[model samples]
Target: MTSAAPTTHIVFPLYPGVTHLDFCGPHQVFARLPGVHLSVASEGGRDIEAEGLVFAGLEDLATITHCNVLCVPGGFGCVEAMERPGFMAAIRRLAGSADYVTSVCTGSLILAAAGLLEGRHAACHWAWRHMLTEFAAIPDEGRVVNDGNIWTGGGVTAGIDFALALVARIAGVGVAQTIQLALEYAPAPPFDSGRPDLAPETVVNGYREKLADVLRDREAAIRRVAAGRANRASQ
Candidate 1:
């Protein structure tokens, strides 16, 4: 008889300003994996007001010393989340025992802030990927990047790609393919404005204009987080 599949503990770090889709899209794929114990953990186990709807609740991180996989989801709240005291330090500690440390979109920023991506390649939302230098992360241009045990996805929807790739690594190609098929993960968008280079110059410019304020604020936040980490390390 075959032995039971090893149970894998997967955790998604939660915050108030998350983008729910970034969390849920990859979650559906990860949850489908066999023998996977998926959980959402926050600094204080509080409910989050994400971009979409409200997240029900999450567990506190105090009891979790490690996990098989830890995925950090990104959204508008990441900047403020970085500012929270001991937040990045806690993530750094939890990541110490994580076999795979991953992120989706701006979630990579959080990982970088935690010092997980120092001198490592990572990807994030195009709008803010440039800010990775603040945390000493190499900005990767791919949809999903797997550098050593660190995996990062670009933008919001790219979480699906990251999840499938990780599933392939953890399980097998057959399992990943089956999950993809079950999810009917096909992309046939009506327009071709997915990336900045592919989109028309006018569209890119418009997006830049719309997000100008957010970009400025996010840049400052990243700098602040980096400085805070530096100061803590010195203490």
Candidate 2:
């Protein structure tokens, strides 16, 4: 099924520590859309490996002259991306010009840093929700949020929901519903620990422990990124 648009470039900004689900989920949904072009972009057309899977065919950020849609995937390396002048510049430039800009997980942080989240209600991984405040973003707890042209999704798997919602918004409810039905989007979690509100105390504690480790590492990287940004600003 071909889309009405001649071409829709869906850009994925790649970096280390990127969650495989973030890109894969959305890619699955977007690929089904007609006439949609997908590009996995990086600082340079360099090869990037996500969770041990090597991607050697990724394009450089500069190759995206214009985009209909931009999909930013989240990872541990967002701080590094935020600090890179060329990287941040590419995001700010391209995403600013994009008709629609969307992000998954902590990728929202990158968008926030690029000053694209102002006055937009966005969502991100609950573990990192507070960080959006640093960028003057109104954070929501939903799995996905669509605020004007900006679309944001919570952690990893939530990207599927976000992408499906975007499909419905752009293509129509019929298209989204069709895809959802084909993909068996019916989700029945074995346990009710998906969110803290529904999880048992022990399950929530375990999730917290896992998040604490990530927070520690993220905090250190964030400080370095902040310093780098400040340095660039001063220069």
Candidate 3:
């Protein structure tokens, strides 16, 4: 009799203010895989509300010391999360022991803050792609980027694509494709405004103007976290 393959263990750290789709999009793809165990982690295992922006599920931090794959998702609350005591440290601890470290959207920034993405090529939301450099990461374009055991996704919906790619890498193309087909993952948006280049100038400029303050704050937050990581490294 052949021995069964060891189950692939996956965990995603959940926190208040995590974007709903950022966590769920990729989550759905991974949940479809066979012989995979998944869980969501939050501080104290408390209910998470995504900072009231989206109705993400409730989860608490996993007590496990390590996992096969660990993921982090991003949202407006990331800035606050960066300022949260012991959060990045916990992430650093988990990523250090994980076989694979992954992130979605600005979540890569969080991973960077945790010192996981340093010296790694990764992907992030287009709006914040440049910020990856603060943590010594090389930025790439498109929906997904794979650099060794570190995988990252761009924006929100890209999580789905990233997870599918990760699944193919772990299992097989056939398995991932079957999951995609089962989910009917085909997407056809009515508008061509997903990216700034494709969107009308007015729409693009308006959003940029509106988000300038938020981006500035995010930059400041990154600097603070980067400093903290550097301090710990030198210690």
Best by TM-score: 1
On a 0 to 100 scale, what is the lDDT of residue 121 in model 2?
89
Q: What lDDT tens digits, residue by residue, belong to model 1 across residues 87-203?
A: 776778878999999999999999998889999999999998999989889999999998999999999999999999999999999999999999999988999989999999999
Q: Which residue segments of model 3 deviate by more than 4 Å?
A: 51-59
- Candidate 1 at 184: error in angstroms? 0.6
Q: lDDT score, residue 153, model 3?
A: 94
Of the candidates numbered 1 and 2, which has the greater lDDT value?
1
Model 2 lDDT per residue over 1-235, tens place: 9656677778888877678788989989988887788888887888887888877778999877878788998987777778777888888888877989999999998898887887678898888877876666899999999898999999888999999999988888999888888888899988877777888989888878988987887776665664565566689
RMSD of each candidate relative to the true structure: 1.4, 2.8, 1.9
- In model 2, state the lDDT of residue 100: 91
If ranked by TM-score, best first, what sequence of candidates would result? Answer: 1, 3, 2
Q: List the residue pairs that clash in candidate 3.
A: 17-50, 17-51, 42-60, 42-61, 45-60
- Summarize candidate 3's per-residue lDDT along 1-235 as a digit string, tens digits: 9999789888888777789899888889999899988888788777788655533354556466778898899988887886776677678887887888999999998888777777899999888999999889998887899998899999999999999999999999999999999999999999989988899999999998999999998898888878877888899
For all predicted structures, in order, the TM-scores are 0.95, 0.90, 0.93
Which candidate leads in lDDT? 1
Model 2 has an lDDT value of 0.84
